[model samples]
Target: MTGRAATRRPGLARVGATLARAWRAVSWYVKEVVGENDYEHYVAHLRRHHPEARPVSRREFERAKLDRMASDPGARCC
Candidate 1:
């Protein structure tokens, strides 16, 4: 292969790596914004602050969070 062809591959590889990193960051941001990370955080909190306590499952955690938010009027933006 020619010298130019060899160099072209490295450039394409760098572009692909950059795109992968960017997509991962975007995916993480979307999950955070949509509260998909809440269960992970809750688990961590329980482990750190209340190791003896049993953490609820994801479905129950979400259901309780929604119930609390609905009952608390101040939890809304508008």
Candidate 2:
């Protein structure tokens, strides 16, 4: 490879390592907060905290969630 290409190798390696660390942190947080159960309890928790979370069909919830995700980059779908 050329000199420039060789120079970029370490930068790419550092970026890859940073991304791996971030992914691991997120994975650990999810496991600790939500455990391995389905999302029903979390939904219920939300309803308890904010009584406005009335019952809605699963299909509608999923559709709205997907739409929000498509429009908002900051939204987390999981």
lDDT per model, in order? Answer: 0.95, 0.74
Per-residue alpha-carbon lDDT of model 1 for 1-78, expressed as tens digits? 799899899999999999999999999999999999999999999999999999999999999989988889695697
Per-residue accuracy of model 2 over 13-60 as CA lDDT, tens digit each: 999999999999998789767643234655787788978867666666
Clashes of 1: 0
Q: What's each prediction's TM-score?
A: 0.83, 0.44
Candidate 2 RMSD to the correct structure: 12.3
What's the lDDT for candidate 2?
0.74
Best lDDT among the predictions, by candidate number:
1
Ten residues in sequence with the least summed lDDT for candidate 2: 33-42
* Best by the TM-score measure: 1
